[model samples]
Target chain A: MTEKIVVAYDGSENAHDAVNFALSIAKAAGADLIVAHVLEWSPYSFLTKTEVEERHKRRKEELERADKAIVSPLLQEIQSSGVNVEVMVKYGHIAETLLAIVKDTGASQLILGRTGQSSLTSRLFGSVAGSLAQVAPVPVTIVP
Target chain B: MYNKIKAPVLGALASCALAAPAAASNIDEAVNEVFANSTGWFVNFIFSPFPGTTFPWIVAWLVVAATIFTVYFGLIQLRGFKHSIELVRGDYSDPNDAGEVSHFQALATALSGTVGLGNIAGVAVAVGIGGPGATFWMILAGLMGMASKFTECTLGVKYRNEYADGTVSGGPMYYITKGFAERGLPGGKPLAILFAIFCILGSFGGGNMFQANQAHAQLTNVFGDFPGWITGVVFATIVFLVIVGGLKSIASVTEKVVPFMGVLYVGTALIIIAMNADKIGWAFGQIFDGAFTGLGVAGGLAGALIQGFKRAAFSNEAGVGSAAIAHSAVRTSEPVTEGYVSLLEPFIDTVVICTMTALVIIITGQLVIDPATGLYVLNESGSIQTVGGNSGVALTSAAFSSAFGWFRYVLVVAVLLFAFSTMISWSYYGLKAWTFLFGENKVSDLSFKLIFCLFVWIGAAASLGPVIDFSDASIFAMAVVNIIGLYFLMPIVKRELTSYNARRKTGEIKKFK
Candidate 1:
């Protein structure tokens, strides 16, 4: 079976670094690269009806912006690298959604960039990389 | 003992604003008279009683509609109760689904709209007028009203208009017109138009003014008597900022704050109830005895039933079709799932929260009792005389404060959050109805928001009598038109429910967990 390398990307410089790292690993193993971006969303948030009605439109716009502004340029630059690459964007917690993507894709390994500073929420809860490293079924790599 | 304890505690934090200046009083009186005089006819017409009976026809209209929907749907509120909880828990939701709103968000929004001053102040009015017996009828009406919500919301989603821009609009207006035309019926547009007009009025009355009035009442209870216009001005400014100013940040802050307040309010009630643990049975007994015998309540059995049904409809808005506007925004392949989800709204608003308020009032012995005759003390006005001359939110606050003097302070904060959150939600609902009638545009949107903000001040400046009468009438007027359309469109919902149930049985609809 062909190998799959899952990379969590959020369009930051750190994410760019993680993508570049994962690309090298995929090339060495002759594997396909899966790029996943997860928008942080909690279902528990209270919203007004107007907000609720406008959410789907906002969500579509966000997804389109992420693809066009963030992923497309990266994809174009990586195209000449001669590796099969795909992208997935979804709304959910970054760590949980990325882990789900890892399992769903049956990837052989998981990789992500580690940010130098953690968000207050991440500090209160746990950081995404820290969470993924502990729970991922496959081998996990954190690129600094 | 409770009164003595409360007085000194409140005295320490009392404001000197108790005495209003002549100028403010003059303005308040003028605004109050103008509003009361102008809306008198509309209120009277909507609340007109049936010939030879004291029962308002509109209350009967809602109760009858709720009863019919209950029977028509085979008590779906009970049969589908488990599934409704599961649907709200996201058990049947696909995480990757591209739905506009989750069941939880839809329910929460709708709840925020319905579960406000109505639960706090409206129940006080019901019990204050109809005695503890009103509680029994209120819960019964709430249970049956669930089915009404189920029908309207199902039709709301099924007939909703989805735009290319990914935005959607649905409610009685969309469903009435679309569902009728789909069934080859004429006059759907006219009925939908009527529903929209009443919806706008309802939003102004129950959704805007009543909330303002009660918030002011609770404030006055804490700070001492002040001109309503003072409270009105402050409320209008804040509402104008949020709704018309498009200060999304303020709206978001309230959204976060209101849910916390709801939990806090409920937690406080639970604590008060637990404190008076022995009175639990006695409170239930009062509720039951009042329900049947009326316990010297004016109009007795009929009076209790009318007040109960009226307050429940006002509070939960089951057949009123306003919630349909909120529920229609939910994202689901099967519109019936939203119907199931909508059923829980009345259950939560009326059965759980409203009942809690009633129990707290009764348990705390806020209602004055005639020890000699074993009946509620009635004043010259023929309504039960409550402690502290309290009415509306003041009465509910008094009940809480009676348990612990400091509870009134916590209640004041909760009441403000509830009232403010409700106004914000209703502004959107009214705007939706307004845009539907005048055509969605910046001009119409600003016009309605301005009018709504104006009413916030008017509501606070005006006396509770006219404001509440107008609120009850306008909201009930929406029910009158919406229920007529529901009768025409219910078969469509039944078919959806049948297909949904069959699909669920065969595992066509996947359960995620």
Candidate 2:
């Protein structure tokens, strides 16, 4: 059976590196690769329901582009190596989405960039990662 | 037994009265007397400053100017609200760009500068004088301020100067001159000079002295009978340590301190609100009523609105051009991106944090009005005192204490942390302004740091009333120069916005990495 590995993706170079690292690990373990991206909802965007739907559509397009740019290449490379791969794009806050995906997928391992799309300060993950580490159902590795 | 008890009780009362003879001469009463005496002097100063009923006239002009600008710019602040979220999300962040810090760090540093005493003491002063109605005007001012922050920060990045050492310098001075010069406009150089002057003065008073004074006061109050000199010396040492290290150090410290203190303070407030959830409705009602009632202690609605707007303007400094100095250092190549992040500042500082403070104060019935005197009685003294008289801090502390009695100590820690962070940020701002006037030589930098440190000591040691009032005036005076620059340079902002939007639409812009 293929071991399942989840990679946190936010389109940053560091995050891309982590995904590449995850894919490499998944290929070594003969595992399926899951790519996840997190989105934060801001209160300032007080758009109407119709406007929100439009915004979501636009965001989805953007996400798709990111997938094309980052995830697709990795998937191709991993599949070429004769490994099973599955893409999971989850949307929500980074930390919560990450922990939830890990639990639901029951993945044996998780991979994340040291810093994602967020600024360097927030990437410390002392609060986000520390909390996740405490309760995460699986072992998580942070790739710097 | 009854006689003996009565005698001792009476003796105790007499002793208390004797011990606090100066208490009868309350601080509020003294302040009121000073105000009454200064009424004539103020009247003369206002009238003589290009004459005919200056206070109301200036106010009328400010209202008209703000209204016209809001209309003329098509309420850019509203548009900025949308962009600000995008900025924080790193939508416009470009790592390959030439700058010192990331957009988020720049915003955090700028916020650390603007969001200090203004949120705490400024709000207190507004609510105390203008009653709850001040909050409404404060919100209005903050909304209008979005355009101001957007304009200044965009210009800041656009006109930034890259030094040989990879350092960047930009603000109103750069924009007023460079932007106007590029557009072939007249008097750009002069306007830039004027803006620089106001900015320098503002840095010394509002940014430097004001922060120090409040920190000193809060520390002394918490640590009873502690010498003011001790407060000054310790704070000055800390300020010197961080500020002398320049923007990199300031960014590092603020990036950590801002989020931690912000979350801690906001979290404490949330706990208080949850505990007093039942009073939330009444608090909102009072805020609305006090805002429009036109029955303030002095000039009624107009007075309240003026005070509220003034406080909010002073607090967030959305248009003051100071934040641009910090935002200019953002690593992003896109100026509008930093502008978007800058927009969040007012929302966080005024809309969220300030609102939390106002609700806590109002819900606790601290803004009590004496029917007989039409004055706010903020404390048990029965004398009408404005909330800024330690009462504001005390009231907030009381609210926290009510929810988590031990949390007041946490608040003290938070305040000190906030105060220290603010001081460091402002020191950098002043240094930049100082460098602009003087050369950027090491001696010039050292001299500015020394003077800034001295003021820190003075602020820590002195009574808050005079220094705070002066600082408030100095900070507000920056608006006079900044708003003018913004008014002239707004077309540039619009052009940049259009181009940015076009790029976003065409899918040329990639998602933030």
Candidate 3:
């Protein structure tokens, strides 16, 4: 069976570096590459009733926007490469969701950027890379 | 990204913050004059008394409607109450559903909207004038109002406008229009239009102004008697910052803090009641005695009933159709689940929380009970006299402070949080109605937000009497139009309930937990 390598992507420069690192590892190991984009969302967070009502709509808009502006462009650039690539977009905490994807895909390795968007939030709440490095079942790499 | 959003918002808030204090004196009178003159006719028309009776027609309208709903729904509120709790606990929820809100979240948000000044200040006003017996009526009205909420919310989900964009718009207006058209009724559009108009007015009076008025009253209770416009301007500035400045962080912070305030308020109330543990029996005795006998108050039993129902209607807003908007957002394929969830709102808001407020006021010896006649003592104005010669939030504050001095400070914090959260919820409801009538665009949205914030100032600057009266009248007007639609569309709700129940019994509706 072919091995899987997962990379966390957030359309940041460090994310591009992480993706390139993951792609090179996938090529060497002859493994499939998985590009995962996790929107930072909390089902537990409190919201106004109006915000709650409009949440589904906003989620849909955000997903479509991300796919169009971030994931699609990356896919185009990487399609000509020999490695099999799959892109996943989900709504949840970045670290937990990426780890879930890693477990579900049975990937042998996990990779992510050292810094991405929402650095301030990461600084306050602890970064996704910091979280996954401790708990990930697979060997983890932090690409700078 | 944080700085990108904060810079503009802080700039706007700072400018308004500076301007409000500087122009306070003249702007205060100008705003008051414009508001009273423009809204006077609408208030008077809505509050016009029934011929040969002192009771307002609007209050009678709500009472009759709630009664009809109770009978028509076969007391669904009582029968489905356990199921309502179950639904709220996520017993039957499908987590994978595409709906925006969970049953618990929807119920919580709706409760936060309704469980504000109405429970605190409105209850005080009720017991202050109508006597402790008003508590009995308030509880009864609250129970009956449950059926009204269940019916409207069920219809709200079934008839809501679910767009391809994944958003929804629902309330009395949508149900009236869509339900009527499906039933082959011709007057749906006109009735829907009328309901929207009443809803907008209700939002302004009850949602914006009443909250501001009572928040100002509580501030005055803590501080000395300052010009209310100062409170108004300050509230208006903060509210304006959140609503128009797109300062979502403030709004979200307020929402998060509100639930804690509810807990604190209720916990403090329990402490006060425990301190007066000896008087619990006598306080309840007074409620029963005052309710039936009127205890020498003006209208007697009927007067108690009127205030009880009025306060309950204002507090829970069951038949008023506002809560339905909040409930409609729940993530349930079974509309009946939302209805069941919503039935818990009035139960929690009125029967539980409002009762606590009323009991606290009674047991703390706020109302002066005449020892000779076993009746409430009345001052020269013929209104029941309280210990501090106060009313509204002040009376409630006095009752709490009588038990624990520092409790008043906590009460002030609770009042501010409650008022702020309620205003935000109502602003959304009012904006929906505004967009429904004038069309949804930036111009209309901005116009309504400006007007709503202005009323916050106006509400604070105005006296409690007219402000409360207008608030009652406008909110009751929403019940008038909404109940008409409920009367027409209730059979549909009954059908939904029956089918849902049948499915649950047959095990077709699987329990998740």
Candidate 4:
């Protein structure tokens, strides 16, 4: 039976290792890979839908840049190894969005970098990885 | 009818006034009796006991050591306060920094670890025994403690290890060893080894056992006849699950729960105080009077001061290096930023929450025990009993119940939440300390967690006299070892501060978003 693994990615070197780790496991277990990039917006500030959409567009470009710089390379390596991969990009709360993606994709496992580029407030409040592990419906592997 | 109403009210007030001297006498007698009966047990089982009371003595020693570090650092806590905030606000925040959590999250997680049952129960005990004067001393100690926290946390960040994988691990053990090694000290390894041993011991008793014991008591008390073993098992199991997941899981739970619970408890206290607005003035008056006069109890002003200082020290745990372990993981280039945020911890824990507890006890006029007879008369038994042999929870409960009818339920909920959250956070502290001593491997981790969980059950069901006393001592002991490290390492902290400030001034560092 094939398993599904969701890997949380940012363009950091650590995220690259986590992506590779996820790919290795995906290959070994013959699992499906869902690469997730969460686009965060400050909850305290107000912005119009048009403004949010504009920001989202900018964030999409950033994600695309990361995909080219990091994620795409990792996916290429995995595909060359004959592993199936699917990429996901969403704009919302990191933890909530990751958990939702896991549920939506029926991911049996989650692989994430130990730390990433979240704002200090979110980090202090906790990371998407920490929060997801606490309440997520599956096992989480924090690649460090 | 006016006479009838006046007479009853007067009678009630008179009885309340009369009850104090009596309760005081009773407590003295009980203390003497317990001391006499428990002396042998204390000597045979606790003093030279397996882990021993030497650990707590170490904490007291840490307090002394921290005091020295504060002086050596030239009272950096005061000078660094404004700068600490600037660091948090990203005046010096570095987004590309190589650490696990943000500076704010690091402080929050660390604050979550320290700001628990100590704030609620410890304050009540101080006010109940030390009189209202204790609040003043507690506030003073809290202020001084900020400096201590600043020193230790600054060192925590400065000496932190940014793992090849980007996971950060740092604390007293890392700094004590790493700092000494850098200095070319001959006994760096030996001293670091000693500190690690003490930290592991302190963590097990103070962080792990004490928290679990308190949580188990509160849970059993609220749920009713659930059997303490059940509470212990459930708590231990949950702790195992989370701890098995390591620091990230612990951080996540603390980040969410700490703020939510802090708000919930503090908000409730605010409402109660507002309702008792008339007595608020009197409460303040009592605090000032008791603090200065040492009135209503024997042993005079000195006794009151000791109680106040003791409670404040115990409550915020500012000087204690245990909190630094949690704070060390914060991702920041500037160490002082975390130090400044750390200052707010004691303020919130002791100044705000503790003051609320003290006021609740004082305004309700419940601090008195008869000097002659020494018995509590308000309740029929004339004696207050505590589960697990520690009086912290019972004392707080009585104070809350007296303030609002049926709000005792609120207190029970608050206590359980406070204790439970505290236990989880402490588990992380102990685990880190354990890894420092035993090596960071799965075997070492599992063994420590297993022992820690067992103690939770023991803490819940066993007599508290030895356990709590020992735990309190252990907590203070960590401060002793940590303060020593901080003292020797103060020069480094000063250098870091100077460098950070210089960067900020020159506009070399930009604000982090």
Per-residue lDDT tens digits of candidate 3, residues B1-513?
334544665566457545767666566567666777777888898878788988888777877887888888788888888888787676776533423466778877888899899999999999998999999999999998998898899998888888786788888888999999999978999988998988888888999899998998898789877777778778887888788877889888888888888888889899889988999999899899988999987688878878888899999998999988887776567888888888998999999999999999999889987899888888887779988899999999999898889988988888998999999999988988888899878879888887888788789988787788788888988888899999999889889988988999999998876
Best by lDDT: 1
Tens-digit lDDT string for candidate 2 (B300-412): 67667877777787788877778888777655567877777787787788888888877776776666567785545544442225333445455566555656778767767
TM-score of 2: 0.69
- The two-chain DockQ for each candidate, comma-separated, is 0.60, 0.04, 0.32, 0.03
Model number with the top DockQ: 1
lDDT of 4 by residue, B462-486 (tens): 4445556656666655665677777
The TM-score-based order of candidates, best leading, equals 1, 3, 2, 4
Fraction of native contacts, model 2: 0.00
Docking class of 3: acceptable
Which residue runs of candidate 2 sit more than 4 Å off their true CA positions? A1-144, B1-69, B92-100, B245-255, B371-392
Error of 1 at B340 (Å): 0.8
Please give the ranking of all candidate structures by lDDT, highest first, separated by commas.
1, 3, 2, 4
lDDT by candidate, in order shown: 0.88, 0.66, 0.86, 0.65
First chain of candidate 4, TM-score: 0.78
Per-model chain B TM-scores are: 0.95, 0.83, 0.94, 0.79
TM-score each candidate. Answer: 0.95, 0.69, 0.83, 0.67
Clash tally, candidates in order: 2, 3, 1, 26
Question: Global lDDT for candidate 4?
Answer: 0.65
